[model samples]
Target: MEKTDNIQKKIIEDVIYNAEKILEAFNNELDGVLDYSVKSLEVIDDDLLSQFHENLHDVDETMKENAIIQFGSYIFEVARRNYGGKYYWYEQLDQPILVTGQPDFEISILAFEKVKQRIENGYEDNIPFFFKGYVQKLATAKKGDKELIC
Candidate 1:
């Protein structure tokens, strides 16, 4: 029992640590627009939502989809909270562009893919709540690490 408890505690710590890294990167990318304090974010549960598990036989595929949606939602929610709206517009050169434009959307897609790859290839830690690569990619994309819009 004690061993189980310790493992759970460690997993929680890892989640919090990863969350902090993600938020920091996000804030940096937006130049402090988010201003997300660590105290504002919390991990509520580790259980998968039942809606994503209707087809038990396709558990693997379902889990992948669920993870993708959840991660995407998290990204969208953070943007919304910080930007004070669900979406925003920016001008690139002389063209107006939506924040969730192709490149930005691809970031979320790639994040899901990375998580899926990690799951299939095997991960050292059983904790599936966070993927460091996904978080880094998001941070980079948001920070305009590539040709993406900030």
Candidate 2:
């Protein structure tokens, strides 16, 4: 039993690490766009600033998709590990919870709330294209010993 628990713990750690890496990659990509936006705002005129902001959004659009894919991949991998690999940490869902930097935290909360609201409202068609699969996977996951308050 001890050995089984250890193995399950390891699997959970691996999933959490993979998710964090995905977040790191997403953050790195956003950082570049944000840095450019900041620098541009410092010197550009109001008219150009609006355009810069628009362009920034255009450039960073892929990051949102990447973030969703990362979470989806995380869910898939966790399910794989628990079922296929015999590491049964699925019983303790708290193990793979993620922590983010303050700015990232704010953005994540806002994005999650938006998604949650859409899902609650039955606005299926309006869900963000990127998060659709991720949210679905999350919804289907079995509740475990660990609860995510957020």
Candidate 3:
């Protein structure tokens, strides 16, 4: 993925690299257990959600913080591979967001926040359900339904 926009590019390079590393680690550690399919949100669940939640109190601050990026990076990769999403730095929020633009509409995902939410609230923040809903909405969206970027 070449740099597209100046704003998004600023962080996208690091994000892309981190995302790739996360995927590679998964392939090795899980022995290719987690497939980067449409329902690949579990990649995040497997990578850090399980750890962070299981050892919430025992974990160090650095691991806790890094887990967000590590898990979120995997989420971005899965979304990119499965949903045709791309990373763009959102200047206002100052973070890279995954944007999957369809002919009818766009599916923008705050992948890190999704990870953070899952780490904090567990299943109530349902990353799988979120992607499932987005897939459903994308399927139902018509060309003339209006172009929404969010």
Candidate 4:
């Protein structure tokens, strides 16, 4: 009985330790992603969007298609970097961070803009709710860590 109990306790402790490490890594990754997104937004000049559209209009048919493909690829890279990529290490943690984005550049931009416009039009309530859920999960995981320590 004593040996069984000891083994169980050890297993629980190991799980807790692993969970803590995963959570820390997740938080660090999220911070980095958020910073990158902010920087990307900052670098977008006022006329860049218009310029992109204008260039698309002026290019030959083949070049236009190529430009569209390249632009889509670029958007995917940015989205992947900013919104969690192929390996979601964070998902291994107690509270996983769910990343949401479209792979299609046209749809991605349209959706992003729609969301932005909605928020600007006073639909900001959902944003807080969404973040609250994420924050609560993190807090819960932190509490779990403390419980494990005790």
Candidate 5:
């Protein structure tokens, strides 16, 4: 009985270790893709930006799929580790408008209520242009039927 218990504990530890390694690999891959996307956007002309804007709805729809949820979970874990208990934590419910800064230096999700309040009260002029866009996207997004915001 004692040997069996020890074996079970070892198995659990191994499973957790393997899972952490997998998550690390996923984060590295995601970081590469995001870096490439940002660089590509930076080099694009105004016409291309306009084209991207025209296709924004389609892109938004794609983002709301399972990938976004998984990505949100990843982001939440990262935030929890880095920020600790400084900010309120929530799972990725619907499509969260991600507010990321230069790779992984600083990243966070904007709460739905906060986004709504910004829309009602108006954003301060000092807020960055990209963040304002994120707020707007969150405002217009349709909430997921099953996922809770908080």
Candidate 6:
């Protein structure tokens, strides 16, 4: 039991660390643009990250994966920081889902999966649109009002 707990704790730590690394990466080449704010995510949308993904094709496979992971982490951080949430391992999906809200309502953000789609589909898969919509829905559930979020 202790071993399992230790492993789970370490996994969560690494997941969060991946997100934190984005800030450092931004300073180097990613335009130093991540502020961990929801608005910042909107900036990275459109062809910004899609173009970045296209450029990654010239690099090693690890670099491509890093592009997905780094931005995926950034998206996860934005949702977690703005609305409050906890990451849980979805064993069936084999993904770390950051679930926000509870009892009254619940909104789960599949940060990594959405990032992959944004890279592939370009503007069609809007990350901010996905996140803000879910959060707004959750807030509406709780408050019984439709106030804009993000």
lDDT of 6 by residue, 1-150 (tens): 777577657756867788787676554465656777887887667535757656655757676577777777778778878887666676765667776775445567777777777776666778878877876676666633332222
Sort all candidates by lDDT, best to worst.
6, 3, 1, 2, 5, 4
- Order candidates by TM-score, high to low: 6, 3, 4, 1, 2, 5
Per-residue lDDT of 87-125 in model 3, one digit per residue for the tens? Answer: 667677566787666555666777777777777777677
Q: Which ten residues in a row have the lowest lDDT in candidate 2?
A: 100-109
Q: What is the TM-score of each candidate against the true structure?
A: 0.28, 0.27, 0.76, 0.29, 0.25, 0.76
Q: Rate the local accuracy (lDDT) of all candidates.
A: 0.36, 0.35, 0.67, 0.32, 0.34, 0.69
Instruction: Put down candidate 2 lDDT per residue, 78-128, tens digits, no spaces.
Output: 334332322232234323232122222211112233322332333331333
What is the alpha-carbon lDDT for the whole of candidate 5? Answer: 0.34
Error (Å) of candidate 2 at residue 47 is: 27
- Please write out the lDDT profile of model 1 over residues 70-139, one tens digit for every residue: 4333433443344322122222332111132234433322223333333344333212233333345555
Can you tell me which runs of candidate 5 are displaced by over 4 Å? Answer: 1-54, 60-63, 86-150
lDDT of 4: 0.32
Alpha carbon lDDT of residue 52, candidate 4?
A: 41
Off by over 4 Å in 6: 1-8, 28-32, 46-48, 56-60, 142-150
lDDT of 5 at 112: 37
Inter-residue clash pairs, candidate 6: none
Mind sharing the TM-score for model 5? Answer: 0.25
5 or 6, greater by lDDT? 6
Task: Please identify which of the two predictions, 2 or 3, would achieve the higher lDDT against the true structure.
Answer: 3
lDDT of 4 by residue, 1-150 (tens): 777567545533443344344234433644433232324322221222234444544647665443333322233234445453221112232221223321321111211222222223333422233333433433454221311100
Query: What TM value does model 1 have?
Result: 0.28
Query: Whose lDDT is higher: candidate 2's or candidate 4's?
Result: 2
Please state the error at residue 93 of candidate 5 in Å.
7.0
